[model samples]
Target: MIAGGERTLNVVCVKWGDKYPAYYVNRLYSGVTRYLDRPFSFHCFTDNGDDIDPRVRLHDLPVEPFESELQAAMQRKGRKGAWRKISLFRPGLGGMEGQILGFDLDVVITGRLEPLVDAAPDKVAMRHEWRYEWKGQPGGHGSVFVFDPALHRYLYNDFAADPVGSVERNKGSEQYYTSMSAFRRGQLHYLPGSMVCSFKYDAARIPPLNLMMEPRLPLDCRVMCFHGSPKMEEAVEGFEAGLLRSTRPASWLKRHWRV
Candidate 1:
């Protein structure tokens, strides 16, 4: 309970390896403090907690029995592995009950995040993959998600029962597996695209135009996601994403992406 006896909003993020430092967690916590108006608890499920802010709660990453086999399969297929995210669906995660709002470490909070917290607050919600949405493809980006652990444990249960088989059937994609799981049960809800825009796909202009113009924030964007390349740090300094996808320095990021 909060000062006014309101429910505490639990905002979560995952950090598994050395790829992202402790500052990433700090930066996200800082953003939450600035943008979220209500009482909230920020949680980080990570393997390493060194240097993370004390105010931010820390929990160990869930270790599935077949995690090694799952990674081996992903490597064999030459697919990027983000399988650990699925573990968040485990029952009673961190002994946390009720609904949780999660974000990828690579995202930048641009405005009031209350809408995201309120949108489908009781269901499993995420931004539909930007590349697949227009083509009528079914894929969840998994960058942002909201779900109650107690209600969604099946996502982890089924996967754990046959981790390797699940990987192969889903072509080693965790997002697709997660998306399809909720989708099949008619439980998947999509966050509005206007609120959760992608940096590379939505904000950056088309190829030739991108070379000439700086990437602009989409109208009504609340969370700017850097999923594939040109992470927040790289975008801030201007990353040359080859000839077709180059990005000028996004000066605006310095304002919100901080610790």
Candidate 2:
């Protein structure tokens, strides 16, 4: 529990359809509680909240007022329909105030979240998106991000103003819009590469000897992001197979799941 004058932080995750099962959400909630230090609240914004655990607060999906022609263009196979999640950008859906961290259901919490929350307030913090670099610089990935609700109203307004143009220009990438907005506003800050690293890129960087030998947890990494290729199930399998390890190793993740 947080003591007096210590601002409370809220974490949110979105579950749209059957793509992500209840168990995955449950595991994510459990993982966060086990790792995050400061007082926090975990909330799930979902279309269907049935079978969701009692511990996790559930909020209804924002409804679209009317069908617009732009909806047709936003449709894509295997992707969560864009409009369904547009409400999150709306003002006051979750009563979210202060600093908030949003994580996708696919992520795993491996260490304390204070570093992310404690990041400079002037800039919005996120991981680099690309694998390889043009120069010596790293890119920003939007999978995990920390933002101040009071300051980032533009993220929502931009989407609302030109839903079609905004989504199309950004290639329907949410993180891209986030980074671009922050960049335009001069409020973007890149988190250390190790904090929100991709399993695909970093795993390949490990020496061949290290790969063939026993898996050693990354020393500096605070959170290991399983972004594109490997899903959580495969990640769990690889960890068991010694192909993967965390900065904070857990013997039995199942046991530590409950808050």
Candidate 3:
């Protein structure tokens, strides 16, 4: 929906350093292209673009004066997850006119993304993972969120106002700020929990009697988000330990990426 054209959904991911290797991004790109039926463009915003696949549009990470200061703070001991705050609200992001879906690099796509793009046009849509809800109060997980660039400028503006304080107030958590900002604007919509199931909570917690049960494909779920401990690496580990069944790498991914 760039200015005056049909609204094609746009999906984006950000990559920096060696924390997540290029194969992960490439595999995600393959999954989106294979599963999504709607017209869309997949892009990766990254600091290191050399090793990324050519099929994914590589945009340089937006640079600003405060970025260096943020980087220094991120280097301090016990600063894991602090970088998420700065990366999620980077300046000049989502300038494109269509709906933008952002995914964390650690996730593995299991279904179509069109449902997310087709969600309500005005509200910012995100998975309502149970962990974020406090004592029945509503909240959202920002690991997978859809927003329109023209509408959510305040997301970055508020962060820019007090970068350091903003990080501290939200404890450097992107989901907290995203939910708070959306709530303030009265433009937040929660997607069903089944759509973004946590592998650790949903998949791994089934009793031993149900250990052989096949994983059910959620009817309303269009995206499966991997947040926290049961990440791709952990899934691999669980399979190795016989606590989980191994899944073949997505066929589309194998066809495109030999590894």
Candidate 4:
């Protein structure tokens, strides 16, 4: 529990390799510092902490115990699975206990985050994928998630026993697999669509009209995630991929993504 009536919001993110620079974490921390009113702790599970801001706590990346299983799973899918995020379920991360809010490094924190921390205080909360299909299957986008690490340790244990089996059960989607764990315990819930949304699905407007006006922010969306092309960094500097492009001068990205 956090002191002084404020909730202890533990916001975490992960990174490995150099795909994204350290400033992504820095800017995200800066955004959290700017918008969140409650006392919060920021953590980054990363391979290297070199250009990261001093305010953000860093931890070494978690090692996968089932490397052979991981490789087999990836080979079966013909693509890499984001099974690494499964590590978040490991016990006692950063010694936090109340609420664990996970943010992908490529997301832009746009507004107050007290809602994500407060809305479903005792459940595993995350965004629902609007564009995917799986019969009787719930698609949980992995960009943002909230749960207690200690309470969810079984996820890591089960995966340790058979990583490929776990992936196969969820069609190789780590997000869905994670949600299934929460669902099994009757603690699965989706963050309000307005609380966590996507940049590509919600923000990327169809263009010549895009030439005239900027993409309007989603109603009450606190964070917008950039899952694919035109990452936060690319969006900040004005993104253009083939014919699909957000017009030049992406000032909105600079406002939130840059702090």
Task: List per-prediction Cα lDDT, in the order shown.
Answer: 0.84, 0.65, 0.64, 0.77
- Estimated TM-score per prediction? 0.93, 0.80, 0.80, 0.88
* Per-prediction CA RMSD (Å): 1.9, 4.5, 4.0, 2.6
Of 1 and 3, which scores higher on lDDT?
Answer: 1
**What would you estimate as the lDDT of candidate 4?**
0.77
How well is each residue in 1-259 modelled by candidate 4, as lDDT tens digits? Answer: 6566654768889888888889889998998898888777898999999989988889888767787777678787444446778877877755756668888887888998888877787678877766542354566778888887766677789888888788888877888788877778887888888778777667767777555666667868899988876686666666666556764445777788774
TM value for model 4: 0.88
Model 4 lowest lDDT segment of ten: 130-139
For model 1, what is the alpha-carbon lDDT of residue 159?
90
Q: Which has the better TM-score: candidate 1, or candidate 2?
A: 1
**Cα-based lDDT at residue 249, candidate 2:** 27
Segments of candidate 3 deviating more than 4 angstroms:
1-4, 72-95, 207-219, 233-259
Top-down lDDT ranking: 1, 4, 2, 3
C-alpha displacement of 38 in model 1, angstroms?
Answer: 1.7
**Per-residue alpha-carbon lDDT of candidate 3 for residues 165-210, written as tens digits (9 for 90 to 100):** 6666665566766777787788888866766655555555354522
User: Model 2, 12-112: lDDT tens per residue?
Assistant: 88898798888877877877887787688888899888877788889876665423734654675432323454455555668766777877776767667
Error (Å) of candidate 1 at residue 184 is 0.4
User: Which candidate ranks first by TM-score, i.e. highest?
Assistant: 1
Q: Which order, best to worst by TM-score?
A: 1, 4, 2, 3
Give the distance in Å from residue 147's predicted Cα in candidate 1 to where it truly belongs. Answer: 0.8
Clashing pairs in 1: none
